[model samples]
Target: MLSPRRLAATAALLAALTAGVLALLVTAGLITFGAAAVTVAFLVTLAALAFLVLIVRRLDGKAHRIDLRIKKYEAELARTTTALKNIETRLDLLVQAVEDSAARRADDLGAILASLGEDRVNAMARAREVEELRAEVRALARDSV
Candidate 1:
């Protein structure tokens, strides 16, 4: 596509040519006097229009550059999001592993507690037997007294 600047430049060149031709025609006494003045005025207005077109073209170039930068940022955001998701996935797996390990440890602790209870019962039975033996010895001592 033709840039606005190029379009405006072409329009200005055409206008200049038109003016020159009309002036030549007027000098040559072909066009009437009043018509040449109007023609020149119209041709002169082309310069402002040309300037406007140039400004638009400059804006267009900047817009294109900005659009490219935006696309680059968008791609970077997508990549970052994907990496975050991957990290989250790894974290979830780690949490699950920890939970599983904790559950197994709890089961092991329960078994240890059960074994301790059995040991406590056995110790209590031994303590009762010892107390009975001591009572027998005291009874013999009393009989001797």
Candidate 2:
């Protein structure tokens, strides 16, 4: 397929050749001046129509290519959207797992602190009992003396 510029140039050349032939026939006294002029006008009109058809066809082809590109882009966008959704779902699951582990660790720490508190109370009670035993021994020694 010829480019629009080349097609226009070819049309213009054809129109010019036809007009030159008509003008020569008029000069030779073969056709009247008015008839020659009308013939030349008709030939130029035909050439103009051909040029317009070529331009319209070229524009249509470009439009088809653009439509194909648009469809391809739309498909790619859909795939990207689906991938993003999957990633979001995985991230949500990971966050939930981390939160659950943290809750378990916190519970374990609380139990350990409670056990330490009980141990401290038991130690205090033993210290008081030892003090009472020591006082009783001293009282017995005084009576023996």
Candidate 3:
């Protein structure tokens, strides 16, 4: 668990120290120069492989987090879509009720107007009958006199 930068620095220091030791061994005739070179190459390659693995693991972790967020957003979107559909259904019902109520009110108003017209005609007929009766009474009085 060292951070990447710390691990890299440590690897570099170790490599340098290792090369110095190998050079001293070669000068003192304890090891061949080719053997020292091969050893250094192997260590450097191993360190590079370790660094690559760490990078891959970190990227995988970030990708997992992003996937989780995407799933959460998709769920929220689904819920919102369902709620909007419910609202649309309620709105349609309300509009229908208002239209029906308006039609009923118009019908009632038409009936009231028809009733008033009939009342006016009946009043006119009654006035004519009363005038005829008064004229008949006056004629009878004249004949008797």
**What is the lDDT for 141 in model 3?**
91
Between prediction 1 and prediction 2, the one with superior TM-score is: 2
Candidate 1: which stretches are off by over 4 Å? Answer: 1-36, 133-145
Better of 1 and 2 by lDDT: 1
Model 2 Cα lDDT, one tens digit per residue, 1-145: 8876787788778778887888789999999999988887787788778778877887899999999999999999999999999999999999999999999999999999898888888878887888888889899989999
What C-alpha lDDT, on a 0 to 100 scale, does residue 72 get in candidate 1?
A: 100
Quick one: RMSD of model 1? 5.1
The lDDT of model 2 is 0.88
Number of the predicted model whose lDDT against the real structure is largest:
3
TM-score of each: 0.64, 0.80, 0.74
- In Å, residue 18's CA in model 2 sits off its true spot by 1.3
Give per-residue CA lDDT, model 1, range 30-142, as digits (tens).
98979998877775776677677778888998999999999999999999999999999999999999999999999999999999999999999989999999999999999
Q: Give candidate 1's error at residue 76 in angstroms.
A: 1.5
- State each model's C-alpha RMSD to the native: 5.1, 2.5, 3.2
Q: List the residue pairs that clash in candidate 3.
A: none
> On residues 7-98, what C-alpha lDDT tens digit does candidate 3 reach at each position?
88988898889989999999999999899889888988988898899999999989999999999999999999999999999999999999
